[model samples]
Target: MGQNLANHLVPSQDYDLICENLAQTKEGADILRLKGGIPLANLETVTPQLKRLKIGAVLNGKELAAIGKILRSTSEIRRFFKEITTPEVPLPTLNQLLIRLESLPELTKVLNLSLEDDGYVRDEASPLLRSLRRQISGTEDEIRQRLVSFTKGSQAKYLTNAVVTMRDDRYVIPVKTEYKKHFGGMVHDQSASGATVFVEPKAIVELNNRLRQQQAKEHEEILRVLRELSQEVAPYTEEIDQNMRILGQLDFVNAKARYAADLKATQPELSAENDIYLRQVWHPLLDAKKAVKNDLAIGKDYKAIVITGPNTGGKTITLKTLGLIQLMGQSGLFIPAGEHSRIGVFTEIFADIGDEQSIEQSLSTFSSHMVNIVEILKHVDDKSLVLFDELGAGTDPQEGAALAISILDAVGAKGSYVVATTHYPELKAYGFERPETINASMEFDVETLQPTYRLLLGIPGRSNALEISLRLGLDTMVVEAARQLTSQSSQDLNEMIADLVEKRHTAEEEAISLNKYLTEAEKLHNDLRKAYNNFVSQRDSLLNQAKAKANEIVENTRKQTADVISDLHKMQQSAGNGVKENELIDAKTRLNKLEQPIHLQKNKVLQRAKAKKIFKEGDEVLVKSYGQRGTLMKKAGNHVWEVQIGILKMKLDEADLEKIAEEKPQKTVNRASVKRSRSVRTSASLDLRGKRYEEAMNEVDRYIDEAIMAGFPSVTIIHGKGTGALRKGITEYLQSNRVVKHFEYAPPNAGGNGATIVSFK
Candidate 1:
């Protein structure tokens, strides 16, 4: 079933996320890990070519191992060449001398001696030296050419043997031995093996020998560097492994998301929530360009919505939309809907949207649907979403309606949500009678004699077939005759249906008008609130200024009165010869004049009271630290109020709380903030050792943001020594950050070049 779905389905964003998440699990890790494998360090060298091939999946661990082994061998050859080179000779200079020797007309002349007279015999000398001397003399050129061809051919064969591409789950790599022309390569021990090919010509063997000697010397230096690098990286090997695993998982997830999108034939909004909801959703398979948008709300109201409409309406399309969206949602992809739409989690989405007739089972269309329903019944639960399109259409009206009702009842009993489209009038009436059932219909235009494709809730449509047929050129007389032969009750029913249609239209228009009025009212309310807040703020500021001025005047008066009293006491003391009562009285009057009474007017007190009236208890409010939603429990003694919020109790003043309506929910904390908190608590930030220069730089940017938000004054980013790519990336991110104060590579005891210590401003 999985394979079948994969084949038929198109990739979607949700699928990609699923695949990636799945790849992160134990199973995915197992797929990438192999025994007796070449180290991943070697594999890094071949990643560029692998990326060029666009190969994303771990086809087999062995294949990756093989590639790693080849790279390791190449590394060894490079080391060997470096080791043989002379220490005194500069690599470039030595390479230049070798090139000149090869360009000479004769090696014997270039060497300033004949090979025959030299202590070295042709065969006794190094094969590389013999080839180089012969080639320099322009002798044995043909032999050198043949050797080059052989080496090139062998190398090509070896690579071909190592790599294979799969098509339709079968490996395709054409391999052959020199003896077999048609049989491809003879499989030995179930694995293809081939000889190593050296493309360099044998006539240039002498040049190769000299080069090898120079390389040997260089190899020792390279080995030393490698040893140091390995030690630097050893501490971070685990971290690098983790990153590779994560990248692999992401690759898988991306692929799945793409596939799901294609299968649903729609783009779904991506979210990381547990529920799915969509409003005004359309069927992807339907010609949305021509199809109407139908508003469907699932997950909260009636589990089973029975849609009843006239023939050729949009009942089936609605069913398909519901099913497709569920499939897309479960796959972790987004669906097309209004921004406010949400989806709920469902374990399974069982759909019977189209005919499932099977001749082999001797089942008619009705029987086929029944069979499918039976299958659904066995597995149906609260976590399952079921959709039945045109249920009971192929069977007798009375029996089918009864059957459909029973099926819906059973499904509801199982606690599963079901949406079934039907044409049975009995079923429609049943929907009206049931509390959990809702009746919906597609609107048809009587004047135009066409389906409007608009779905109406709480209504059932009448079959306007005969009337439409007549309008479409059928004889009016025939339609009239047919109507006459119908029972009186039936005729009354048709008239009642017409009356209901008119009322529905009127109701719809009134609903639209009401919405418009509500919108305008809301806008007015907001404007008034803003104006009131501004008025209150200005009033408070003005009152504060007035109070300050009053205090200043009072202080000045007190100072003047104190100075006058001191002068009065001095005068009394000086007039000790004969101090009259009238003179003392005059001194007191002067003091009284200096100290004028300070009293606030009644209007000032009223203004203060008015300013204090803006805040009240029991109001839903927003606090800075609590984000956008907190409840004001009660006002404390003076201005403080105690509030309860999400396991936190805070005592805040009126100035700290901003009133917010209860209707709107608060925005969630940012994901980066959450990750930062976790990192701080766990002390596990990203380790960029062994990563590419670009990757390390990206990690550095992410880490800095996280560290700052986590309240870390400083952090250590480990960037192991390997060409300094990781170090460079860390330094670059640090330099660009406004928050970063400075950074430096750690000292040897701390981590050396293998880590960087970043200080945050």
Candidate 2:
């Protein structure tokens, strides 16, 4: 179970990363060491194949000694010599290859080659190689001949019908004998009063000695090569190991991400805000194959949710889904959610789910639950997400409901978010009375007498057990008699139960219809938003083009006018000094004509006022240097006015303001206008909103400029305190700003510090 669970938790590809992170954690470190894969890169190369071999074989003394010798000799002899002789440092290409041979594919191939190939070539040049090869071959041939000769001699005798010799110990053979004389040539150990005899033949004994000598020599050679190779490759060993480790980590991370995505049933879009937001979320483990998807909304509005439903519903699954998703998210995996889903960082996640009762400890279900709850209560604060499956369910319903409500109230008061599942009716009623609590239920189909597995919000379910039993063919007379024996209040409760069932069913149908509508509406909304954005972008582009065209026309007109003036001045100079009075008048006339247009142009400039007092209270104005606009709320001075925009309040001079309208009465500040103005101002100071790449950069630039100009020691710009756009925008901007001394999110005390505080140089 552990291995299988590990397989799901850490993918083979991501094993390295999991191992590295595991190495960092106390538990992971222990597992990694126990697995004997340290510096996980090197360990990983061996683990896959190592898993296949017997543990005893891999860890045996002979094998270890052999491996050690190979590594030492290869680096010291082969690699060192190559490196010193080469122009550049020689890399152990072959050595690296050998190290990688520990992988399954390579090891399998090596074993196959060793077994299939005789590889008995005698080296003619080197006497040692030749002698070793000859000795090995000769011993093998002599052993074969002697075994055949012994068997033939034994068959001729009457002691046995046939004889066979088999290798047992290193130099010993078991010989089944038909003749007694052949056994005299070899030392024999009788088995069970000489029914079978073990023989130590001279040829076999000499073969063992030769084999040992050859093995030792081969071992020495391999060790020499391995040592040299290790040295040559030593530089890149760390890097390779690191890469392998990273690869392992990535594999596990990717798997976790994929699982989260699958569990979420949708892809979560990457964002900079760390706040988690989900709309209509369903529990992934709630028999999703058969269960109806529940719509759960969380994050922005209700940070904590209390779910109430009848017994045998899917409350536990809901808790598990939430807990699992959070775990997946923190491990740096993608979550399963809509593109708009935003998940935040949590310090810890505690769950009190499943039947935790322990008979050995003399604890009842309630006591067990209480113990777990107490542990959770002690550790949880804001920034932690708590899940309780069937909180306070095993004790008396009245007291249990009270305990549950109190626990929820306490957690909520601490500002920590929680989600708990319960079946207590009073607890469900409590949801209505409490402002922070919301009611939800797992639906049951009355007609079919089965759980629909659909979750409905804003409503609670009553146990439909009696109704279901009746529907399932229980005797009507028995049911009627039982109903008669019940109290009037109980009958009335049953009637109410019937009504709620009808309402719940209706709600379930309506919810399905609504979800279909919502899906369609969401798609349409997305399309419309895209089109609107495209139109705005195109309009901006066209506007820029028009401005460029207008500038070109104005420049052309100015150049033409200058040329005409120059020509007129030249003509006036060329006129002779002794000309007739009429000619002199004509020359003066031409001069006057040329100068007239110049005077007209100068008058046009003078027609406009040098300064216009267009500023008014409640008027929206654009600051020239600043990219944002604000509304004028009060007059501060002859040239200074106070503006209230979005979350920003500032004072600006009239010279820096331009009225949005040329000729209009001051309009009342509508909510939308105020919102737009606020959005504009917020945009200027690193809008930590849902901004992306280039858009964020622009905001950062504006923020730095504003911070520097305002001479603020430190000023905070609100970014919604999410994990997405705002935070990313601020960090990226801070990276390059020359004037920024430092910037970070404000401390928790100041509005929970969802804003970024920047100090300028």
Candidate 3:
């Protein structure tokens, strides 16, 4: 089925849709951990049987069994897909197909109970069939006993061989031809040589007749059973046929997916424009272990690529790879290319690949190629992909090069994308001379005298004939002589190409080094940012704790003072003249002085220090040690100042601080203000319980971003175990998230399957 699907091309209008569906099916298979469903090996086409039933033809037991097997498999498949195709892990395209599959419980159950695996009707199928078989068994046993007795009797000598067998559904014994009349009641058969005759003994003739009658009755009962099963299937002929068709379609889709997985292929991004970009793509037919990968792109900035190089340098392979992958993409199959590879849908694909010489037609290689090129030019358009291998070859070099240029010109003018491979150096010049064409080549190693098979785009190929000869033990004098005979213009072009290749190699190496350094710098920046956030969090936590403790102490002192005053008033009331009101007021004034909050005195001291240019809280000071400005928090100890700078907190000696500016007025802390401050603080866990899938994902994304920014090593997402939609969605999201290093279900005590612990990179 996969081969059949691959052999044909899908229409361009439906191509992208088909590819998208196939990609979704592959994703569904991955999520389910089953390729498509149960092994389709047991699935057999039952369309013919269904057709027979539709025409009122009775289906045998085997045909019915085949149909039953399909029905059962369809049910299993429907159930399997339903297990994972929830709101969280939605597979819309595949789900549409699943929706059409109807389970036939009654029909399947009846077929399974009535027929055996090998298509024979079971005795349990009906009581009458069982009784008939039993009677037949009993008569057959009696007939065999009587025959054995005859074999052991006095007339046993007449038997040619003392064995009983059946001829024409009747029990018979082999007898010597001369004694046939002595032993037989009836001659059933005679041997080929006329030496023996098979005789039915007259002694058990009536028993044999009874056994035959019983056997006929059994046959009638079996047919009746088969007919009943067929009638049961007749009503479901349309449904059964539909089920088979759906299963075939699903199997075909799954086969493409399995092929993609096995090949480690990725879904290519289809584009509206006729631009191609294949990254690290190799020929699918080649041994991936040994095949060299190359990147090629065209049809965007340039409409054609003229690949010029010596024979066996993989120029042909490059052409074939591009052409084949294009077709594969259009056929709705994932291509054997790296991720992010982009392909365009072409209305037509023309290839003049390989040798096309014809003997019967008396056409030369050049004529054969010309015939193909002429045909290609007729229909080539902007949406067409044209490939010409060894174009204009087997002819004069100058004329062939000119013809190749003209053909490329014609094709490019038509706005068609063309890739042509040739050995003509003139075409290399043509690639440079033309505006919409680029030069490309396969790398050759002069030292190894072998092609590296690495494609270098934007650089023309060098023959390196002299260099190769020198490396292969040719004398230096002869090599130098050969090089001297070459035209200086040709030598200059090769030299320029060599220089460009070498420079490109050097640039690539430097780019790799720069990228490495850039990555290291980014890592360092992230580490510093995380450290700052952590410090800020701890600082704020400690500050809040200290403020709460201070507030508690002030409250306790206030309560004590109130209680003391009440005691004093009660004593005055009791003592009357013993304690005067004036004295009581004076004592209360002293107590009031002591009852003042500590912060009030500290504020007075701060005011007095400010008059003398002394640093205090609310003063912005620059720390000499870090050369960064910070707000003065408080005095930590003698001559030590605690300061807050961005996310960092530190204690520095007064001598290290320089007053930079005065701080602004502090705002009164309120409930809303505290809540706003706490909102930015990252926590070790987030609760998403009872949230919808989209809502949960939004929270997850925001939470993870904050977690990474705050430098949390890992955070738990509490989605809770309900329908598992949220959990599955979160897991999949994390898998594709660039920042998330890994994620897994939390431990049993920590929400178990209900939560995921996500660790960031």
lDDT of model 2, residue 471: 88
Q: Which structure among the candidates has the greatest TM-score?
A: 3
Residues 1-761, candidate 1: write the lDDT tens digits: 12333455443335444433332221222222321111123223233324423432321223333332333333433343355445542334223222321111222131122113221223222345444444444533443443334335444453334433322222233233342332232232222354322122333445445544544544444334333323433333333333333333233433444443343333333334323445567766655466577666555446667888877787877777777776655454445554444455566778887787888989899988888888999999887788888887698888888988888899989988888888888887777677667777888897797788887765666687777888888889999888888668755654665577457546645764687799999999999999999999999999999899789978887888788678777766766444333334345545545443434355787668555546667676765432435667787868788875533345777655667644545576321112123221225345876667776676676556445545577888887887875666667767866667888888899888788888877
Worst 10 residues of 2 by lDDT: 672-681
On residues 1-761, what C-alpha lDDT tens digit does candidate 2 reach at each position? 12233465522223234333322232222222343222211112323222323222222223222223223332333333333334343223322333442222332233232221222221432346456566667766666666556546533343332443444434444555544345444644666756556665554566666666776675554444334333433333333333333334433433343344345444333222334544445555554355455445455546666776666677777677666655644444444444445455566778888887888999889999999999888888777778888888898888898999899988888777788888777876676677756667777788976677666665566676667779889999888887777668755654565577457546655765787799999999999999999999999999999899778867776676676567556755665433222233333434333321222344645545433545567777765434356778999887889876444566677655667754454576442222111111122244445756577666666554444433345666766755666666567767666556787777788645467777756
Backbone Cα, N, C clashes tallied per candidate: 59, 42, 0
Q: How many backbone clashes does candidate 1 have?
A: 59
Residue 358 error for model 1, in Å?
3.8
User: Relative to the true structure, how large is the alpha-carbon lDDT of every model?
Assistant: 0.56, 0.55, 0.78
lDDT of 3 by residue, 114-161 (tens): 887778888889999889888888888888998888788697888888
Candidate 3 stretches with Cα past 4 Å from truth are 1-13, 24-37, 83-92, 153-155, 261-264, 472-761
Which candidate model has the greater lDDT, 2 or 3? 3
